[model samples]
Target: MKWTIYQLLVMIGVTFFMWGMENINNENLIAQPPGEWTAVNSPLLTFLATGLLITGFYFIFLFEVKKKKNRFQHPVWIYMPQLCMAIGGVSFVLFLIGGTIGPLGGWVEQMRSLLYLILAYFLFLIFLFIFSFEHKRNRSAQATEKTIHLTFFWTLMLFFGLFFLF
Candidate 1:
């Protein structure tokens, strides 16, 4: 994909925004010690992070569908895995990066928690239904969907596993 100055700026802005949000403390209503400012227990952060994730993925989904000439008429189930995988993979990377060298260091313990399992389940269902879709003779649509689905799954899995090695 071609990178434009505007897109790069927006991404940088989002990264900073996420970093700022991750550092917000909803408890105590006051500042903590210099090194204790990380607030991994804030529910607001969790909800905000989830909302941002969904919104980002929604825009990406729309762009992908429009770019690839795919319609939104596909069953909702066909999209769930793709959605969850995108969200989960993004969340994992953000948290992983933040925990390693940013404010989310406090979230390291929760990094590989139950959410990953749930995402994995959705990913599994995506593969299972990949072969079950009745695309009939619309080979292009079938190929497109299959390509998108497999690409998302494998790419996420590969990077996720790689990140855990260090």
Candidate 2:
């Protein structure tokens, strides 16, 4: 049998999805046990599951980039990190509130969620830079190629970025 990078990546993604799904109902996977001093077991599990799912999504993004043969140069990829940032934010919030006693336990889960949130922010920032660079290149090409119109979203983002510098 022959396999390509895409196939391998897809398989890895499937594996992550499966594990995440399995963990969704597995209470034992949490570091803390039920009726324990730490009330963060659920939150920790939620964060772990979210991470696994996002990792799978990332592999899907890689698979798309590789299959398209753009060398991952397309500006559209900026959305992946943006989505990840959103996901990570949600996970952090869940980790924060998943416990019955929010003010009491789950310090470690909070820290882990904070780490994931920070990583997501970094990834989003990096993709923003990449998108800016690619946008300039594409804009230059559009200038020389005589494109009549840009999508409404593109036009909106351009004006917004000009105003906000984001």
Which stretches in model 1 have alpha-carbon errors above 4 Å? 1-13, 25-41, 68-166
Over the stretch 1-166, how does candidate 2's per-residue lDDT look in tens digits? 1225665766666565555544543545545554668544465454554444444444544444345354345555446445546666685686557545574256535454444444445444433343344444565565311211232234334434544452
Q: At residue 73, give the lDDT of candidate 2.
A: 50
- Cα lDDT for residue 75, model 1? 67
- Model 1, 1-166: lDDT tens digits are 3323434554565556555543453234544556565545444544455444433333344344444344444666455546656766776687677657986545435553333334434434443233223232243556555544554454445445544563
In order, candidate lDDTs are 0.46, 0.46
For model 2, what is the error of residue 115's alpha carbon versus the real structure, in angstroms, after optimal superposition? 26
TM-score of every candidate relative to the true structure = 0.32, 0.30
- Per-model clash counts, in order, read 0, 0
Compare the candidates by TM-score and give the number of the best one: 1
lDDT score of model 2?
0.46
